[model samples]
Target: MKVSIKREFDFIEYEVDMSDATLLEILHEIKTNQENSLAYSSGCRSSVCGSCAVRVNEKEVLACSYKVQDGDRVEPLKNVEIIRDLVVNMDKALETNARAKSWLAEFNKETVLNHEDEKINALQSDCILCGSCYSACPVYAVNEEFLGPFSLTGVWKYVSDKRELNAAQKIETIQTNGVWDCTLCNECTLVCPQGISSKADIEKLRMKSSMAGYSDPNFGQSFGGGFGFDGTPSF
Candidate 1:
């Protein structure tokens, strides 16, 4: 099978013969047999670490989990700087998380949580920070300042916590460069390996922002206002 990889150096194609193998397996085979210098990143091959994320046919997926196909066009995750062959620099995602302050702010460690809230939090907390949603996001492509799906979803997780009293502040953080920027494309929801719906989480954030008195920045404006050249107001 022949696979094309878009590396930082150039577009390099490799051939590998393997049956019932994952994409990362083929990559490792290429590195071991064909080219000794091929570079990629992977850990916890069980899809828990989320370090083996890449784009197969322009869609983000976990290389370690996705089955390899013949004539596949494999590439590094988009909206990021490629560090090597399949590896990308995740510094931007890390920086965004810090800026969003995805962690819980004030909480008494002594407080015990009930089962219901814990269950809800667990659903959002299972995120592995794979950057798949970040890579799959279209908003980040045009606007780098916008907080991508994973970051916003992380914010939602914290903001929804029963222990959180600063929901208003967190919602404010998401209103700018966060929820408003999302096109609600649902790409992040489809590609998540953990079954987390970043789109839905972001929508919830948008609703919360509206309740917080933050409206869409362009709620009333149109392309050329509501007036036509005939002096008639256009709807």
Candidate 2:
């Protein structure tokens, strides 16, 4: 079968004997045996690490889990600086978590919990920082400073936990460049290896923000002149 890979400034094709092999295995064959210069990232071939995320046929997927087919197109993850062939820089994407303060500041010991208390945030906790959701997020493409789906998912996880102490402050922190900025495009949800619905998490945050007396100023407004203007004269 022939596999096409998009390297920097070039599309390289290679025909190999990797019948019914996983994408990662195909990449391995291409790199170790044929092309010594091919570059990609992978860890834990079992798909637990999420380091093997790449765009297979323009869709973000964990190469460790995706079985390769004939004439497959493979490329680096999108909307980031491509350091090398199939190896993109992930610093900016991971930084969103720290920027959004997506962590538990303090836990409430006094809060009583049931056996299934953590179930609300179970989905968010499954994320392995694979950059798959980061690669699939559409909001990050247009808004560089937008708190992305991953961070928003983290926000929802912490804020929903009954043991968390500062839900109100968390809600306030996400008022700008956070929940409201998310178009809920569902792109992030589609590519997650863990099946996390980041769009749904953002929706939960929006609802929480509304309950906390926060609102999107651009709500119901049309985009015009770099402002959310609804065809109204402001003179």
- Residue 64, candidate 2: C-alpha displacement in angstroms: 0.6
Best by TM-score: 2
| Tens-digit lDDT string for candidate 2 (1-235) | 9999998887889999867789999999999999999999988999898888899888999998899888889999988889999888888988888878799878898988786986878878999888887778788888878889888899999998988898887887777788888888899989999999999999988888776665575753544334533322233
CA RMSD of each candidate after superposition: 5.3, 4.3
Worst 10 residues of 2 by lDDT: 226-235
TM-score of 2: 0.91
Model 2, residue pairs in steric clash: none
Off by over 4 Å in 1: 220-235
lDDT of 1 by residue, 145-213 (tens): 888988998899988887876777777677668887789999999999999999999888888776666
Error of 2 at 89 (Å): 1.3
- At residue 52, what lDDT does model 2 achieve? 83
